[model samples]
Target: MEPIVDTVVIVAICVLGAALARRLGFIAPLVLLVAGLGLSFVPGLPEVHVEPELVLIGILPPLLYVAALQTNLVAFRRALRPILLLAVGLVMFTAFIVGFVVHALLPDVPLAACIAFGAVVAPPDAVSATAIARRIGLPRRVVVILEGESLLNDATALVMVRIAAGALGAAVSFWDIAGQVALKAGVGVLLGLAAAVAAAWLHKRITDPLLDDAVSLLTPFVVVIVAEELHSSSVVAVVVAGLYLGHRIPYLLSATSRLQMDAVWKLITFLLEGVVFLLVGLQLRDLVSHLEADVATTFRVTALVFLTLVAARFLWMYPATYLARLFPRIREREERPPPAVPAVIAWAGMRGVVTLAAALTLPRSANVPGDLFVFVAFAVIVLTLLIHGTTLPMLARGLGVREDTSAEDALAEASVQHAASRAARERLEAAADGAPESVVDRLRALTDSRSNNAWERLGSQAQETPSAAYGRLRREMITAERHVFKIARNEGRISEEVLNRAQRELDLEESQLNRSDD
Candidate 1:
């Protein structure tokens, strides 16, 4: 199939699946996966062979970067111990366990090959983690740990895959592998910090919103490319850069730029995730065709490998949770979670596109078969997404791990806004001048109206306020302007550029008015 046509088809499927998922009350990625799988078997449809580079470099960075952007810095810091245990220690542990099980399943597969495959499948996929968290009511801490682990674990897995491959090919020593891991990790961190700090400095100097947005879009790609060129972990670079930038956003960005940047990145992240999950599903047909083992043998080995990976995560999480609490300071200072949190975390493991991408990179060696390795990795991702992804929400519910609620969100938001409103009023008073008393009063009214919205939402349902009526009228005016501009474009009275500029002004005005309600 032509590349453009194929890309269009995949995107359409993803959007459709995502829409269907929401209507059916399932996670979007799972639906997209199933859609891709079903579409793969269509008659005369060509199989998709996504270049591993496209996903790893092109898609992965921005996804991680945006995810890190939404991360709460304080929560992530508090959960650092468990996050590292899952992200780094558990990744390595799971890889070894997976390697052992795969080797046991297929005795002919070399230990190196087994480990290589394990590394590919080690990390629990971030997409499933985020998507399921939104659909289900995962606690804030659980969400933080899952997201934080995701942002770092891929780098760990990738570096380990590289080391395992080298050990098999060139007889590399254990200490050498350890040194390589440390050096790459350290360099990656330095590179990410430098990149993030430099970007923020430049951002401070740039006055144009368009230029600022362009830099923001390019941030993740540049961070990843530079780190990769320097023989560091691009994934780590993206994550670190994201965290730094997100942490500084309140201080660094103008209100307009923050709003624009938020919308742009959200759109970008959504599209990338959809494309990835859809592509994941589309590879099923190809994987089945290329397996070297008989159908029964392949089924047995893949199931065993997939099951072992899931079991390995559960086995590792509970002990690690307790291990962290063993420190007196940690136990004394922090809120101790119920044991059910670890169980839900364990059950939340669902491998996705990253594993598939890594599997595609496996080279056929003297002893190892690349096709078989790819097949196993592919099976593990699909099987887990099918089994674990489908069941995780229910499992978390059954275990009483639910804490996400509108009430909690509203309470937190109300508290932040309440404090911010006080600060805003003080700043306004400090800057007061010969400006009209009415202007100052209007500003104060807007601040109070905005801050009290969440509380009002949680309280009694009331009649429409005067402010809401004003906002509704303003939106109608903006809608009229949009329609007029669009008509002029259709009638050839205005150029496309002119129409877009007009529409954008109207859109921004509408947004400002709408935001006043909240």
Candidate 2:
């Protein structure tokens, strides 16, 4: 009972914190972290210990899957080079440098254990970064790079963690680590592709949105579990499966199913991220109490490590951006991004739950001071979140690196809508030969209205457009209709089932109108 009650209270606090952040125009995760930290210092409050398995096995997969699902595959492919540089190459570089520095600072700690700690903090979680980017309308290319890096970096860091752990037990050679990487990558990608293909085939047959969403929800967990059992990178497997399925969803699933699945995933992600960030903050008291080193030394090392991590990312980003242009084909294919772009990318390296979780997973016998490593990781997360989360938007704006693609996006949307409307007109012509003229005309009007609304959105917004006015008026009508329906039901003029069915129709139409306004 106590456990259940605690869970409820925690979730309530997370939700409330997030709501407050939204209202105040602050980053929700950072706000939640600060709130949790304050709560942790309250006298008589129980220490909150977030289990690593709970994070690694339970929270991670779904979050990764959702991020992958939302990522534009085409954009991801275009940014593949930069993504790999940061996700794989920079991770290795940061790990080695941090390992050497940590060994120098704490001579008693094994190099392998130090490297493991480095691996624990190498990958930056893009959840917060992407959120800030989208909110501030940063360039789409930058967002793609951040999202793509996040999808794959976890796999790289986890692989490094495993190698370092092996080294702690026995000397691990470069060739051994290389072989493990190839094996894990090969197995994870293959299994993920197979799982996605099978799931896609199954989902196509399941027309019911609820059942389809059920399968969709289960896919990440299933793929992750199987990949883990097969000694592959579960993170890679889940991400690949999600990307594949998300790409195919438009063709494979019904519109209703897609809508339902999206809403479900968004809700799940919101709750999970909220809980994870707050829990991370609530851990401060326990981590500080369990520190194996003096508090002063622990904080000093943490500060140094945090600076090292920041410096390493900036050091890698510039070279990674400019050096890739050495090849003629590469130079011709990709334009050099402005220096500010790289600066923004480098500074957006905020760590999150994955780093803390990885630190907790470090082997007990790895000759690393477990509490110290955890504390450093926690401090890094806190510092990064607090500093980067607050300053990233300001930096991007100050650097004149913001996106101004509204006109371009509107034009693209209008073009797509015109093409869609033309196709629909052809389909209607082919199938509606036997239909009533009124019905055919109504369908045509709706199609034209949709296309026109999209184009109107591109026009100047000095006053309300016809489509906006229509949507606004129609919404009022829907409200009125709903009121009357309730009155009818209250007067026993209609059955409950009838009222519900009628309301559903109105709700769907109102939703369509609202979407058009966007």
Candidate 3:
């Protein structure tokens, strides 16, 4: 009962924190972190201990799944090279280098333990990077690359962590470890693909929105469980399944199902991400109390590790960006990016909850008397989230790394809408032979309105457009209708069902208007 109460309180805090952050024009995770940190120090408060399994097994999958589902598949394919380099190559490089540095700083700790620590902090959290990137309006390609990298980086980092943990117990050959990683990852991918296909097939048969969403919510958890039983990379399994399902569902599912799925996932994502950040911040108080060493030495080592992590990312980004062009086939296939793009990408490597969770999984035997590695991981997460999260937008602006795609996006949208509207109109005409003339005219008006709305958005920003006027008028009328409906319900002139049906209609209309405004 107490645990249930605590969970509810935490979720409530997340909602309030998010709303407050939006009102103050700041990122929700940042705001929630500060809030939780403050709450942790309240006198007589019980320590908030975040269970490692809760984060690793419970929170992580859904968050990653939602990110995978939202990723732009076309953009992901275009940026696959850079994504792989950052996700796989950079993560391995960071872990390897950071391991040696940590070993040099603390020779008492086993090299394997140091490397495991590095692996814990190697992967950047998808929520933190994308939240900051999207908030600051980074280039779409850059966001896509970050999204793609984040979706897979966890698998690479976790695989390293597992191997490093195993080495702490006994001598493990490099090739043997390599073979294990390959087999595990390969199996995970195969299982994920199969799960996605099977799920999609089942969904095509299930038309009920509630049931479809129930299955969608279960996907990440089911995949993760199956991967775990098979000794495979659960992260990869969930991500691959999410990507395939996200891509396939839109083409096959009904509009209602899609709408419900998006709304459900969005709410789940917002609450989960907010709570994760807050939980991380709350861990700080407990972490500091459990430290085995003096504060000064721990602080120094943490600072060094943090600096090495940052420097390593910048070091990896350049060669990875430019050196690939050495191949003639590659040089001809892809255009060179601006010099500053790499800098922005490097600067955006903020760590978040995943690092802390992975660190917590490290055995007590691995760290000896104290969980120094866990403390350091928490410190890195704090520094990265606070420093990088806050300064990234400023850095992006200073570097002139903003992607100005407004004109191009508008042109593309108008073109697509125009073509789609024309096809819709033609289909309507062909089906209208025996239909009422008034009904056909009404359908034609709605089609033209939608097409015109897209084109009007591309018009000059100075004057009021027809679509704008229609939206504004329609919204005002909706508000009046809503007021009347409420009054009718209050006076018992209408039943609850009728009132709900009327409200849903108004909601659908307003939602359309709201999207057009965006």
Candidate 4:
């Protein structure tokens, strides 16, 4: 296919798949994966050459950057214990368990190759986990743990995979491998922090919102490229930079810059996510061709490997949660520890692009059966995507560990308080004018309607008063404001550009308020 035609086809598939996923109540990435699978069967479809470096460089930096930007660094810091246990400890545990099992089951395969397979499949895909977690209403803490794990574990896994591959290819020592992992991780962290601080400083100095927005758009790529050039982990660099800059973003950029950055990144995230999943599905043919064994043998080996992965997660999570509770810091810090957390974690082990990219990047000349390792990785990805991803919501529901109603209520109350505050401020501003009595009265009524006195009273007395009826009215007022702006622009009372800018600001404010509530 011509380059333009290929681009059009990819865009069409992504848009259609995203829409279909929403309509069918499934995640968009899953739809994209299925779409890619179908497209792979078409005779004239252009081949998607899988590149490992591109996965980390082209895809991961932006996605991780956005995720880091969205992540509440304060919350992450507070939940460090759980996040570390999951991100660092759990990943290592999973990798070792899978590696050991693979080596034991297939004695012919070299130990290093088995470990490589484990490393590739160890970390869960952040994009997939975030999409599903949001849909299923997973607790904020649970989502944080998942997100933190997804961000950092790849660094550890990649380091291990490279070390293992080296040992198999060249007779490297355990001491050398250990030293390299520590050195890489340490340097990567420093590189990431430095990049973040520099970018944030640069952003603060720039006064023009448009210029600042452009800088923010390019910041992640800068961090990733600089870190990788220095032989450090670009994934870690982008994530750290994202977290640091995101934490200081309010102070670093103007309101306009922040608004533009949020809007642009949201669209960018959607596009990258769609492209990653589509490419993942399309790479299956290449993976199949790389396997040395027949389809039946490959299926059997892959099935066993998948079972090992699922079992290991369950085994690890149960003990890990219990152990976490044993610590006073953890127990004191955590909210209600859902009894079904282990099961939820187990079911959430759906693998995606990261694993596929790692597998396909395996060195063709590496000794100890690189092809088998790729096949096993593919098997895990397919199993997790098809079975675990499909059943995760059901699992959460079954465990009674779905959305927490009380927490959501608290979030809603907080939102109502913020809206009430904003309304009061607007009312006070309008009341400053020498308006007529009727207008003043209407303003007062609106202010009273938006008040959160009932919520405050409930907080003090443990009363079960329902949320005030003002939320709907507040939404209506906002909608009316937007409609008025649109009409004014159409009537030439205001320029289209001005109206658009105002509308975007209002929409962003509304979105922020809603997210705060959630």
TM-score versus the correct structure, for each prediction: 0.90, 0.98, 0.97, 0.83
By TM-score, rank the candidates, best first. Answer: 2, 3, 1, 4
Worst 10 residues of 1 by lDDT: 169-178
Badly placed stretches (over 4 Å) of model 2 are 172-178
**lDDT, candidate 2, 1-518, per-residue tens:** 99999999999999999999989989899999999999999998899998988998999999999999888888888888999898888888888888878988998888888888888999998588888888998999999999888888889888989888778847755456657766897799999999999999999899899999999999999998899899999988998998999889999999999989989999999999999999999999999889778878887789889999999999999999998899898899889999999999999999999999999988875357888899899999999999999999999999988988989989999999999999999999999978999999999999999899889988999999999899889989999999999999999999999999999999899988878766
Worst 10 residues of 3 by lDDT: 169-178
Shift of residue 15 alpha carbon in model 2, Å: 1.2
Pairs that collide, model 4: none
lDDT of 3 at 76: 83
Model 3's alpha-carbon lDDT is: 0.88
What tens-digit string does per-residue lDDT give for candidate 3 at 298-356?
Answer: 98889999999999999999999999999998899888889999999998898888888
**Candidate 3 off by > 4 Å:** 169-179, 366-370
* Residue pairs in collision within model 2: none
Q: Best-fitting candidate, measured by lDDT? A: 2
> Candidate 1 on 373-467: residue-level lDDT in tens?
78888878888888988888888888888984777677888888899999999999999798799999999998888786656656644787555
Q: How high is the lDDT of residue 467 in model 4?
A: 34
Off by over 4 Å in 1: 169-179, 462-506, 512-518
- Judging by TM-score, tell me the better candidate of 3 and 4: 3
Best-to-worst lDDT order:
2, 3, 1, 4
Instruction: Candidate 3: give the clashing pairs.
Output: none
